[model samples]
Target: MNIRLRSAVAGDYDAVNAIIREGQDEHAEALPDRFARLDQVVAMGWYRSFSKQPNKEIIVAECGDKLVGVAMLEMKQSPSFEALVPRTYAYLNELAVASTHQRQGIGKKLYTASLAWARERGASSLELNVWEFNERAQQFYASVGMRTLHRMLFTDLT
Candidate 1:
């Protein structure tokens, strides 16, 4: 497969959004209550903002002119709560491979490209979050050599 990896352009909005929606569907399967299907408007708004961010990048994996995967990255500086230094890092905000093309290494290629982009931009680390119940995603992240830096727990008080 002659899959091409490149930065997302304006015309890629719909394809990228579709991939993310597929991701949301996967997440919703894990938590039907908390991860309900997102409205296209909301998803599009978020994607538009991410796309326009000066320090953010939306990368796409396309095969024969069809977008098969997408990964969004942002350059961020974390608050120095543990130390006196503010550390710059790369935040992986979103990543998804087309349902039809998953497990074919498209996701891996997107991740590898994003990592290289982050490193080239002088980021000290790369970080991303996956819901606790998404075992598949957790495994994927771990397989890519990412260790959990923290955990977030929530409880319903109603």
Candidate 2:
């Protein structure tokens, strides 16, 4: 299958939202308390606002006339704290492939493109946060040469 990667256009909002919804559904199912299923409009609105940010971008993978995947990326700077070194980095906010098109290497392609994008912007590193419950996502990230930088622990109070 021939797939093309490009910066998302205004017309691609709905397709992007659909792919995002697929990922969101998995998150909601895996951790109902932390994630709630979102309406399409709500998702689209959030996407719209995110896409408008100067330091953010939504990249899409197109197969023929259809959009099959998306990656949301942002260029961010570490806060200026006395204990922390100041640096710029690329954050992978979200990466999702339509359920029908997953496992066909679309996600990997998107990841490669994301790295290139970061490098082009002179980012010191590419970073992201993946929940512990999402083992599949963690495995995928590991396969892509991403190692855990740190872990976030939490406690539940009933």
- State which candidate has the highest TM-score: 2
Q: What total of clashing residue pairs does each candidate reach?
A: 0, 0
Return the TM-score for candidate 2, rounded to 2 decimals: 0.93
lDDT of 1 by residue, 1-158 (tens): 88899988878988887888887887787778778786561266676776688789999999997999999999999886976588899999888899899898898899999899899999999999988877888888889898999899888886
For model 1, what is the alpha-carbon lDDT of residue 3? Answer: 82
Provide the lDDT at 116 for model 1.
Answer: 95
Angstrom error at residue 140, model 2 = 0.9
Residue 84, candidate 2: C-alpha displacement in angstroms: 0.3
lDDT of 2 by residue, 11-72 (tens): 99889888888888888999999998986823667677666886788889999999999999
Cα displacement (Å) at residue 71, model 1 = 0.3
